[model samples]
Target: MEQTEDEGYHKLDHQLCFPLYAASRLVTKCYQPVLDELGLTYPQYLVLMVLWESDAVNLSRLSERLKLQSNTLTPLLKRMEELGLLTRQRSKQDERSIIIALTEKGKSLKSEVPRLQQQLMDIGISKEEAIQLKGLLTKMINYISG
Candidate 1:
């Protein structure tokens, strides 16, 4: 019998994107419990991590760092602001720009980051494998972005 189009290809197993999507979801799932303890969602945790690195940055700069659109980030930032985790203000140099700065409450969460990172150590992958995987993924990201 001649194989049909669906039978010959176009299956989930044949798509490279499927496993990448699944792996990304599963990795995010692994962060759930730990994130709950800190009262953060995955995206919120990401915003905090970025701010921890650079505390006062403009919204456009933040959008670039997070690789998220301003529309998507606005509500997230508003919620974070309401939570007192961060604050947003109009920049003196440019009123058009919103500046984000971690509040004292947000800065206090920095101490718990090691606990969050411990989740990675608990995962089965060895340090070397994790590093290699991150490098490859980063390359893929750069290539796609470039």
Candidate 2:
């Protein structure tokens, strides 16, 4: 009997998806130590980024911006609250709605973030290339997301 090859699997190097997946995981690992110092997880950092841009957004808006569902945001928000980073409160006008506002501690984190961002950029990525990469990623994300 002759052995036949299965077409389902391809060389890892030839698969474009693997590189993106691996790069995403690798980048998250790179951020892990820095984020751990601040008592944040990677996803929490994403939420913080959203809040940093808009301090007093409602939960729905925050969820939408982060592309997270309420179930995921709820636990993350609880952890952030315990850390005294942010507060989640029911809106006075609407019982169904919740608002997320940064505590002073959370607001203070914004200043430190740019330095961390710079540190990441310094790690084997040129400034010009970083900008170009960001543009490409942004375009790709928008194209797929939309």
- lDDT leader: 1
lDDT of 2: 0.84
Tens digits of per-residue lDDT, candidate 1, 1-146, equal 34468685567776767888998898888888989988899999999999999888899988988889999999999999999999999999898999999999999999988888776676678889989989998898878867
Over the stretch 23-101, how does candidate 2's per-residue lDDT look in tens digits?
Answer: 8898888788778888889898888888889788899998878777999899989999999999999999998999999
Per-candidate Cα lDDT values, in order, are 0.88, 0.84
Top TM-score: which candidate number?
1
Q: How high a TM-score does candidate 1 get?
A: 0.89
Runs in model 1 lying further than 4 Å from the true structure: 1-9
How far residue 40's Cα lies from its native spot in candidate 2, in Å, is 1.3
Question: Which ten-residue region of model 1 has the weakest summed lDDT?
Answer: 1-10
Residue 12 accuracy (lDDT) in model 2: 68
Which regions of candidate 2 deviate over 4 angstroms?
A: 1-9
